[model samples]
Target: MIDAINRKIIAALQQNARISYAELGKKVHLSAPAVAERIRKLESAGIITGYSVKVDLDKLGYPILAMVQCKVYRAKEREFKALLLSYDEVIECINVTGEQAFLVKLAVESLSQLDAILEAFIDLSDTNTMMILSTPVDRALPETFIK
Candidate 1:
């Protein structure tokens, strides 16, 4: 149901969520009130889900970022997911297709901590982990689709 103006608003908000309504209005050629109304409608329609802040995990003492692909036993999927939910270190867990059932992203202070976390999952799943060296393209969404 999004029109060209709404698409522009979404694109602008994606770049900077903290943008003032008045400033955003200027960008989309609308009044502040109109901009606010459109944003509210977007939220009500469940398009604009939530806003978040990006943080430096390394500075926060979680220097190690690892991607753990887990091939969970069919009977143990629920148990494996329950364990994943308990850990604060688990930043993202995606249920995906392939040899792996779950792709988990973990941030930890050290290799020892990472090992301990992996040990907990070994009973229910076989894991293949890769430490992230650098993220050249992090969370890049297509602007072409928006336009």
Candidate 2:
């Protein structure tokens, strides 16, 4: 179970992942070595998975964000997963319930590219697509829950 001090450490990391151990120690009122040990423990326990750099997909020439809900044939699930994983445009693919089997978020440069991608899967799956207007609430887990 996470204790109060550990919660503080997690909170600090969430705000700024690049913060040095010494800086985090100062925020959480622990020594740098103590903070380092706690972070290592968190990583070992699988609470802290990994760090990633946030990028601007639009600036990188991938302005189009599309969400695809695919009603995939049950037997073809494995093949479909492999196909989705291989696609460079697929940023996230989730196994979902209801009529849809897979929900995928993809980035592309143009409508033609999006059309080509969906057409590739239409032979084996019933797919629906929606364009993302904006990411209004993109965030990590709120620190209050850990506290």
Candidate 3:
């Protein structure tokens, strides 16, 4: 179970995953080894999943970002998922309840590229897509949960 110290560690790591254990320990008022042990425990308990890097899609030549909501028939769900897994342009995909079966985020260099990616899904799902203008709030997670 996570305590207040763990919450602080999680918050610091979320902001910068590359923070050294010694530095992190200083922030949490623990020794470097203690901090390392706590982090190891968190990892073992699956509380700490993995670290990732944030990249600029525009700088990478993928300026267009689109959120595509797919209404895939139950019978074609597996095929649709398989096709989605094959596309490197797909940034994220989530299955949800309601009118839409899956929400897919795609990053591409041009409108034509986005169109081609969308076309592949046409046979499997009815899709509604919106180009992302600007993300005012990106990925933000609560450091501590209220019980």
TM per prediction = 0.96, 0.96, 0.96
Each prediction's RMSD over C-alphas, in Å, is 1.2, 1.0, 1.2
**Alpha-carbon runs more than 4 Å astray in model 1:** none
lDDT of 3 by residue, 1-147 (tens): 688899999888988999999999999999999999999999999889999999999999999999999999779989999999999999899999987879999999999999999999999999999999999988547774511
CA-RMSD of model 1: 1.2
* Model 2 Cα lDDT, one tens digit per residue, 1-80: 59989998887888789999999999889999999999999999999999888999999999999999999987888888
Clashing pairs in 1: none
lDDT of each: 0.92, 0.91, 0.92
| Sequence-dependent TM-score of model 1 | 0.96
Residue 132 in model 1: lDDT: 97
Q: What does the lDDT come to for candidate 2?
A: 0.91
Cα lDDT for residue 73, candidate 3: 72
Question: Model 3 misses residue 31 by how many Å?
Answer: 0.5
50 Cα displacement, candidate 2 (Å): 0.5
Q: After superposition, how far is residue 33 of candidate 3 from its true place, in Å?
A: 0.5
